[model samples]
Target: MGKIVISSNVTLDGVVQDPDGAEGFALGGWFHRFAGSKDLEDWAARETAELLGVDALLLGRRTSEWFESRLRPGGGAEARVSPEWADRMNSIPKYVVSSTPEPPRWNNTTVLNGDAVKEISELERTVAGEILVYGSYQLVRTLLEQNLADELRLVVFPVVLGTGLRIFDETGGKPLRLVDTRQMGDGLAFHTYEFVRG
Candidate 1:
């Protein structure tokens, strides 16, 4: 079976909201506030390249909506994606886990409206490469609860948001194994962990 990887950009306090400054929330854009140094950028680039190898990209409803809106014609955040990044994104297959959405506007996107774990499991069994999940906070929570994630790639910035979305919910659980951890020059940290099933 292929691996299911969850990659996210989170603050020191675990807020994974709009880090790109596109969201209207005053405190939504925290990623830019904590600028990382060269070491951090190099680490991020390597991680991103690895994630791009995943056969499919899984997204939550809200994240799918945000991406669609930004990629939409005449959208305000259309400039967010550079030409190279746009091409890279377009090359990957995207699967959006949503209930209300009819269909996504992206060229290579599929709508998954059923049980998240079952669907994801089936995809892993049939897909040829890793399954990557990015930025879908709610979906990530659900996957964690169901023990569907095989690995977690956390890019933690140096700032903290006292009150915002958190990476881990209050679902009582055992500890995860800290597979690896690295500190970057810009105070950014990279942590790789795996759920230690009993």
Candidate 2:
């Protein structure tokens, strides 16, 4: 069985919105402000490794479109993930959860318009490696609500966005056990948490 790992670059305030400023938030591009530090580079390397470990990806419609637009042929390199990350993303099986039909311009992408919980649960049964969800906050919430996610890996940045689209919902009471922690030189905190069930 595969593990459902929820990953993100969030703020101290649990705000996961518009880190790259691509979404046009007022505090957009906040994550880019810390780009030049060696700590960020190391963090990126760690993220790349974690992402490469996944055999499949679960992404929401918007996030999927964002990734597909940048990852398609002849797209600007700056608009995509790192070279290593790109290689893994292109090769892995991507199941996009979207109600609408979208022609995926990227390679190895599949659209799953059925029930989120049922489709993802079925995917977890057959996948031998990790099934990662990155930058898909809505899908993450659904997975957590259904108790389907196995691990939560958060790369928290130093900035605190006072207001933004947060990952935690009002009824978000999922139990998580701390599994790992690493503080980077650039003041970023890397945390790994496993889903806990009574």
The most accurate candidate by TM-score is 2
Per-residue CA lDDT of model 2 for 118-161, tens digit only, reads: 99899899998999998988888888788998998988888877
Q: What would the per-residue lDDT of candidate 1 be over residues 140-168, giving only the tens digit for each residue?
A: 88888888888888888888778776778
TM-score of each: 0.85, 0.93
Error of 2 at 13 (Å): 0.9
Clashing pairs in 2: 21-29
- Kindly report which residue stretches of model 2 are placed more than 4 angstroms away from their true locations once superposed: 78-81
The lDDT for every candidate, in the order shown, is: 0.76, 0.83
Q: Please state the error at residue 152 of candidate 2 in Å.
A: 0.3
Q: In candidate 2, residue 79 scores what lDDT?
A: 47
